[model samples]
Target: MFCLVLHSHLPWLANHGRWPVGEEWLYQSWAATYLPVTAVLRRLAAEGRTRLLTLGVTPVLAAQLDDPHCLNGMHHWLGNWQLRAHEAAGMPSASHRDLGAREHRASAAALDVFETRWRHGGSAVLRELIDAETIELLGGPLAHPFQPLLDPRLRAFSLSEGLADAEARWGHTPAGIWAPECGYTPGMEIGYAAAGVSHFMVDGPALRGDTTAGRPVWDSDVVAFGRDLEVSYRVWSPKTGYPGHAAYRDFHTYDHDTGLKPARVTGRTVPSEKKAPYDPELAAVAVDQHVADFVDTVRRRLRSESERIGGPALVVAAFDTELFGHWWHEGPQWLEQVLRALPEAGIEIGTLADARARGYVGAPVELQDSSWGSGKDWRVWAGDQVQDLVQLNAEVVQTALDTIDKDRDANHHGFEGDPELRKRVHDQMLRETLLTVSSDWAFMVSKDSAAGYARDRAHKHAHALREIADAVASGRDEVARRLADGWNAADGLFPALDARRLPVRSAETAAFAGSTQ
Candidate 1:
């Protein structure tokens, strides 16, 4: 069985900068990836495909997709895409005119779809597919924190809250999760069981590369599905992938005047100015060949893996949802064709939920510290270069936990204080703290991809958290309320989030956590 997983996620970028980094990241993914990807799923579902794949739209991304601010901003961004296309039409270069004509058509379709269907936000589209059983939706923590380094109490709280958030949007609480970075700790399955998560993803090496089927973690019913890198890398890999094909549009080569990508990836290391113009016909041909190649690769792997495992095998090829259309302009087309072609090639395709229900599961295994990042270990998040972020996360999380517990101990519901104000203070404090714990900050810093912005964002949220916590500690109730209210104006996404709901661990659990990392 072939189970494809697409994890859709982005850090909260609502009030962050626009160009060069923040909300621009969100808008670009929304327009270039989310819109087209969902459109493809809907088209396939219309053709009677059910349980085509497992889609994990992280809770943070889901919140933004449904937010009023993001919805309005997305509309404006689509309008801007059309304007840019029009400007490209008047450029003197024939390649510029061709690119303009193509983009104008694409942008026009995207804009109309945005206005008619997506104005309410992406939940409407995803919810429809979920209800139809077209795909299995997956959930993750509210802010996509690296669970391995997070405090156990906060970790459980994040997972439970994230599942609840998904239910609110999609009308289905996911039983599966695309664990942030596919990061795992030895004892995490206990938290997963508590949160009612039956399955989660892990790197292939975690299961000793015998990722033929989902393995139960330890003795619990919670299962960990490992990504089959052999098959997955055929499409996307660090060294090479179909995206680098010469016929595909070069993501980095752009019509600077119009901001449209107009060149093909003529050569891997070739400069953008020297690249050839993108040809849709050539791209279509490449897509066909790649699709055929991927289907054959999966078939061969399924046959070999099944024979090796002494039973039918499960091959899961997972990737970030943004890889489609956003990074590889032809990705959505490739995806649609692959889903169609796989079934015809005699390979059964289903969601992760289907694979589990069909008994494609193995005996319990003791998983270890792992992530799908570099080296397939915790170094990407906990490496030396990012030690400061690791320290910041540790300190802020501990402080937030201590402050919340102290508040409860002090007033037993804040009898001597404004109860509503106290709750708001703690809620916003936890919000800021959660934002700080996002894995993106350390990732950006380690990779030097907007390291400065990542640091500024991390510090900004850290400052908000400290300010809010301090006001309450100083008996400044009104000041605390204003501080939380102001922070909510920016970091607002999970509207129903409550600090009071955050899990309060017992002494035994806390001591265990202290003894570990």
Candidate 2:
């Protein structure tokens, strides 16, 4: 069996900012990736394709998608896209004008889809796919924090709350998670088992023992599926990948006049101005060839692994969901073609959940700490490049927990304080703390992709957390309330979050000691 997993995630950006980053990032991904990808899934579902694949949509991204503010913003952004296309049509270059016309039509279609289907929010759209059993939805923590670096109490709290949020939206709790960056520590399986997570993903090196099949972790029944890099990298990588094909639209090169891509990749080292004009027809041909090649690769790998294991084997290929239409313009069409072609080629396709139920299990193994980042270690997040951000996160988490504990204690004393007011303050503190710990800012800074922007975002959240904590501690109830309300209105993503669920370290420590048997 072949299980394809796509991890879809973006940090909480709604009401934070927009433009070259922020909510614009969400809108571009929605119009270019989410809408098109889901359209493909819906078509397959209409033809009764069950267990198509496994998709992980993080709680933070889910909250933003479902937010009315984001929905309205996305609607406006699509209109802007249409307007840009119209402006492009009058460009002096014929190719540029054609590109604009094509984009204009695409924007129109997306606008229609959003107004008719997605106007309700992303949950409504995803829920339809889940209800149809077209895809197995995987949930992750409220924010995509690097779980291994988090305090154990926070880890448990985040996972539990995240799964609960998924259930509230989709009516089913995910049995698996695409762990943030596939980051794992040795003892995480205990937490997974406790949270009712039956399976999760990891980098191939984490299994050190074998990468052919899902291995039961340590002594827990929870299974760990390792991504097959050999297969996944064929579609996307830093060096060679299908999107870099000379015939495909150049992702980096955009026309200055209309801000639309009008050239093909042309050559690996070719300058933007010298690149050949994009021919969608040529790109279509490349897509067909790549689809056939991918199917054959999967077939060959599955056959070889099955023989080696003395039985049928499973090959899991995973990738970031945004890589599809967002990065590679023709990626959605290629994906739809691949999904349709694989079944007819006698290759069985199913979700990770389906693969597990079919008994694709191996002996238990102790996995090493790992992630899918550079060196397959924690360097991308905990490395020297971003040590300052790491320190900020540590301080923010501790301060938020301290404030929550202080409020809990005051409530226990039956103080004259309004319970509702205290809860709001605690909730806002937790929100800012989670935003501060998001793995995105550290990653962006470490990669140097948007270091300044990333650093500013991380500090912004941390500052909010500190101010709320200080206000609460200083007995300035009115000041604290105002700060909490303002931040809540700006950065709030998870409306279902209950700050009371966060674990108090002192109580959790005693509970851990009691459960050691």
- Indicate which candidate wins on TM-score: 1
Per-candidate clashes come to 0, 0
Native-to-model Cα distance after best TM-score fit, residue 478 in candidate 2, in Å? 2.3
Give the 10-residue window scoring lowest on summed lDDT in candidate 1: 413-422
- CA lDDT, every model vs. true structure: 0.90, 0.88
Candidate 2, residues 90-138: lDDT per residue as tens digits? 7787776898888889999999999999998889899999999999999
Write candidate 1's Cα lDDT for 345-370 as tens digits: 99999988899999989988989889
Best by lDDT: 1
RMSD of each: 2.0, 3.1
Model 2 misplaced regions, further than 4 Å? 414-422, 507-517
* Pairs with steric clashes in candidate 1: none
Candidate 1 error regions (>4 Å): 413-422, 512-517
lDDT of 1: 0.90
